[model samples]
Target: MLSTKTLFARTVQTTARRALGTTTTRGKHTVPDLDYDYNELEPVISAKIMQLHHDKHHATYVANLNVAEEKLHEAQAKGDVAAQVALQPAINFNGGGHVNHTIFWKNLIGEKNGGGQLHDGVLKSAIENKYGSLDKLQQVVNGKTAGIFGSGWGWLTVNPSGQLDVVTTANQDMPSNIGHIPLLGVDAWEHAYYLDYNNVKADYFKNIWRVINWKDVARRYDEAMSKF
Candidate 1:
C-alpha cells in the first residue's frame, strides 16, 4: 500500500531495526541497510537505481508485509478461515519480496570489493561441471532469466539432488517454493534495469555478472550442499 513515490522516498533504510532474512522483532518487519553504499555497484548499477530499489521498493514490501501479517493474526484470532485464506496472496507477495530482496542485496558486491570474481571452491567446481565454465553458467542463467515474461527473478539454485540448476520465478517468488536452494539470483524486474539499461534488459542481465558476489554464492553453495 505504500507505493506512492513521495512516501517511498521516505522509507527508512539503516536506521530501522530489520531482521535479516525471515526473522522478525515484536511481530514487525523493518528495512535493513545495504552493506555497501548505494553508489558502490556503479557502472553496473547506478546509485540512483540502488537507492530507489532498496529504500523504496524493498521497503514498501516490508511495510506492507507487516500490515498483512497483523491482519492475518487478527483474522486467526477470530477463527476467520476465509479471511485467512484471502490474506495468502498479500502475505506471499510481500513476504516473498522481503525475502528475495534480502538475498538479492547480499548477492551483490561492488567491484572494488572483488564482486565478480569466482574463486576456486565447491560452487565454482559445480558450475564448471554443470555448465562447462562460469561464462557458460552466466549465459545459461541470462537466457533463463531473460525469458521471464514479466517481473520475476532468475536463479542459480542447488537442487535436492545437489546439482546446479538455472531457474526463473514469476513475481517475487523464491527458489524455496520449488524446494531449491538459491546460490545466486538476478532480478529481472523492469524496475531493476529501466533506469540504467532502459529496454535492453539483456544488457542488464549480462552486466549484473560484473557485480555478483560470488563469495556469498560460494558460502550459500556450501551451506546448501551440506543439507543434501
Candidate 2:
C-alpha cells in the first residue's frame, strides 16, 4: 500500500489536473443539436420558424457569448474593472439566450411521439394541485405569456419553496436569476412566432401546447425536487 503522504500527493495531482481541464474547456458554448428535425413541429410552430430560431438566432447567441467571454477574460487578466463591467450585459444576454434556447429545444417534440400527452404522475399532480388541471395550467401560462410587453419568456418553474409557479422574464433574462428552477418555457420574442402567427401572440401560445414535451418537463421537475 502507498504511504499516506504519497496517496495525498497523487490525490492533489489528480484534482489539479481536473481544475486545469475545466478552466481550459470553459466558456466554449455550442448550439445543442435537436433530436427531431426542424420540420417536425410543423402546423404549430412551422418549419420556417424552427429553422430560423434554432439555426440563426440560437447559433448567434452561442457565437456572441464566446466572443464576450474571451474579452471578459482578457479584462480580468489586466484587472480592468470598467472593461469587465461593460462586458456584463453582453454576457448575460447571450448566456441566457444560450441557456434558455437549450431548454426550449428539449421542451418541444412532434405530436406523433405523444408530445402533448401528460399522463398521471407527480408532475401532473403538481399541476393539478397548483392550477386545478393541466388545461387550466395551460390557460394560466397563456394568459401570463400574452401579457408580456415585449421580447421575453414565460416559464413554469420550481420556486424556492419547491412549489410549481408561473414566472416571466423579459429580454432573454433567465429564470434562475430569480431563484427559480425552470421546468418549461415559451418564447415570447417576435422571432419565435413572426413567420407563423403574424402579430397574434396569443395564437402562438395556444398552439405551442400541442408540441410541448411534457415528459421533459416532468423529468426536470423530478430533478429539481431531488435538490430541494
Candidate 3:
C-alpha cells in the first residue's frame, strides 16, 4: 500500500544503514580465536608449536595485512600508481597468509573431537570417485605435499570443472590465486613442524592426518558446490 517511490527510498535507506554497519564493524581483520586450546592437539602437534604458530606467526600476518591494506587505501586515495604497485607484494603475501591461516585453524581438531573421522557424505564420495578411496587420497595428497621444494601448502580443492583435485602452492600462495576453492589445506612450512618433527617434514605430513577436521572440509566442499 506504499507508493513505489516511497518503497524505493525505504529500501535505499535500509541498504545504506547495513553498509554503514558493515564498514564500522569490519574496520580491520584480526587473528581469529581457535575453538580448542593450544594443548589440545598434542602428541601429533605439540602445544609449544601451536602457541608459536598461532600467537606469533599467524598474529604477525594479521597485523601485516592490516598495515598493507591501510597503505593501499592511502595510495589509492592519493592516485599514486607507483606506490600502489610497490605495495602489491606485501598485500599479496600478508593477505594470503591471513586467509590461509584462518582456514588452517578450523581444519584441525583433537582426536576426541571429529579429527581423523571422514563422515559418510558428499565430500567422501567425491574423494572416492576421484582418488578411489580416502586412504589413497591421503597418500596422494601427502606425497605431493612432501615433494614441495620449500615452504608451501597442500590443498584439496574444487577445480574449474567442479571435480576434486589435490594441489600445492609455494610460500603464502593459495588455491584461490589459481582459480580453485580450497576445501582443506595443510601447512607445509617448516615452522609448522620444526619444533616437534625436527627436519622430518614427511613425518609431519603423515601425522597431520590424525588431526584433520574432515567434517569442516566437507562443509567447505558443500558450500563451494552450492555456488556451481
Candidate with top lDDT is 2
True lDDT of residue 58, candidate 3 = 91
Error of 3 at 11 (Å): 31
Error of 2 at 146 (Å): 0.8
Q: In model 3, how large is the Cα lDDT of residue 199?
A: 83
| Candidate 2 regions with alpha-carbon error over 4 angstroms | 1-27
lDDT of each: 0.82, 0.84, 0.82
Off by over 4 Å in 1: 1-26
lDDT for position 195 in model 2: 93
Q: Which ranges of candidate 3 are over 4 A from the true structure? A: 1-27
The order of the candidates by lDDT, greatest first, is 2, 1, 3
Query: Any idea what lDDT model 2 has?
Result: 0.84
Q: Deviation in angstroms for 173 in model 2?
A: 0.5
Number of colliding residue pairs in model 2: 0
What's the alpha carbon RMSD for model 3?
8.1
Model 2, 30-103: lDDT tens per residue?
A: 89999999889989988888989999999999898788778866775676656666777777788788888999
